[model samples]
Target: MRFKLRPSDDAFYEFFSKAAANLVRGTELLNELALPGADVQSISERLVEVEHDSDAITHELYNKINTSFITPFDREDIYRLGSQLDDIMDHLEGVGSLLYLYGLTKLPSLPREVHEMVNVLDQQAKLTADAMPRLKSMKDLREYWVECNRLENEGDRVYRMLLVRLFSGEYDALTVLKMKEVADELEAACDAFEHVANTVETIAVKES
Candidate 1:
């Protein structure tokens, strides 16, 4: 067996797992939008709270990276993973805030495709949360990143369909504009999840 020398800092892994779990919370809030008579304003407020929590976790991770003489992985990879995870939360918060700000909740219901995007995000978040702890062993990660990439592709297809519906004149032009903004954020969040997976794959490769 090949031997390797590295610091035994579990804090780095703990931070990643916490950040990822926060993402799961963020996506769960987005899923709440699909409920009948959902409170968009309340969901937006909660998303802000979750986003702030993610930011705090990322800050702590960065400080830990600076202080630690050795890290679980490359220092840059840790930072990138943390930043990308925070980006996903930002996009989730954006979706909630835009829906409330544009009064889109007043519509009878959101497009089916919007919920589809949320479902994709929810899957991605759960996958990332499951994979983060696996970083400790760097084993069985291929399946995680593979599944994440597949989900990202699925999200892209759903996103394209969402745009098609938005531009099909099903609603007034103003409503379409507002919804497109929300759609962009959802798509960005999906992409951000993929970025995190890609970073994980990179770190796994390096440490192998």
Candidate 2:
């Protein structure tokens, strides 16, 4: 399989980059929402806008894939990439939704691992955005996916620590349930980022 540095139609790469930017925005909003005394409603609204923008970009990508005679990568790969990117936004939005629904006045003070996990996720989103446009060349991109995988591992460790603390007679059972739901959503967002990375790696291998 031979890959070209420039595709006949560059719109796909452009859309991918746009979608990645949306993901980064979503991650940043999530980090903000995770902070103490953060305005949850405002941050959630921002995430909602990001998700809507991403959806439009994803739709444009598929439309281009359908109409274009040539593409930078396999059509299926393009579809998978768009879908996984959308999933990341969805999971991030889910985090915000949980925060609002739980009606908690503040983020939990105990078992403070969520902040670190969101930090890793934010880094992963940035790395992914940096790598998406370079897909045309498939050049020096393996490091991004590798780092995302590493971050996902780190997130898992933090998640498990939080879970253990949550169950170890910390808050009441109801509070634990609410906190666990938020934690789980954050962890799922990390996994969604890994899925995006994995899809990018697969596309690179096939194109290589």
Candidate 3:
């Protein structure tokens, strides 16, 4: 193990935790837009604000990385974790953008599978946020990454089912295309969360 003479900066952890909180807000707003008679434009506006806030947090994190001589974990891990978290928010914002751009009046009673996928995104964001504070000790963090892997796997199965239904003559070709786009964004968001969890696990192992 490489020993550090200087104390590592811990501000990155606080930034990460703040970013995760913003991500949860983004997902929650996206999920709200999925409800009946939801104001898609208004919710998208709110998400835009959340996305901007997250971008600011990300900028601060990278600035910290560049200035600090010592980091709480590996430098590349810091970059990847911050980038993945930003991607999750970006995709959540994409979901809202698609709703408005597609002129979808209301998400037709989304299949249970699709709802489950959104639920997983919400849970994953909150779990990641909760785990960020534990980075100091790197203790009891295995469950977070393990749960992330399981949720990503579950999201994959649901995504496949969604595609099959999209092509099964249940929706017109145009409608199928639009719904598929939304599903793609949601799946990408879940994948982003999994990537964050993987990075955290790697950092923990190295630090431990």
TM-scores of all predicted structures:
0.98, 0.92, 0.93
Error of 2 at 143 (Å): 0.7
lDDT per residue for candidate 2 within 1-208, as digits (tens), equals 6446646566888998998888788888877887778888888888888888888898988898899877777889889999999888888888888877787536445357777877888999899999988987788999999999999999999999989888999688998899898899889989999998999999888877
Total clashing residue pairs per candidate? 0, 0, 0
RMSD of each: 0.8, 2.1, 1.8
Q: Is candidate 1 or candidate 3 better by lDDT?
A: 1
Q: Write the per-residue lDDT of candidate 1 for residues 1-208, one digit (tens) a residue.
A: 8677887688999999999999999999988866778987888899999999999999999999999988877889999999999999999999989988898878998999999999999999999999999999999999999999999999999999999999998999999989999999999999999999999999999999
Index of the highest-TM-score prediction: 1
Instruction: State each model's CA lDDT, in order.
Output: 0.93, 0.85, 0.86
lDDT, model 2: 0.85
TM-score of 3: 0.93
Candidate 3 accuracy as lDDT: 0.86
Q: Check candidate 1 and list the clashing pairs.
A: none
Compared with the true structure, what per-residue lDDT tens digits does model 3 show for residues 1-208?
7674546566888998999999889878878977888887899899999999999999999999999877777889999999999999999888888877887646557656567778889888889989988887788999999998898998888899888888889878898889889899989998999999999999988887
Worst 10 residues of 2 by lDDT: 103-112
Q: List residue ranges in candidate 3 displaced over 4 A.
A: 1-8
Cα distance off (Å), candidate 2, residue 157: 0.6
Off by over 4 Å in 1: none
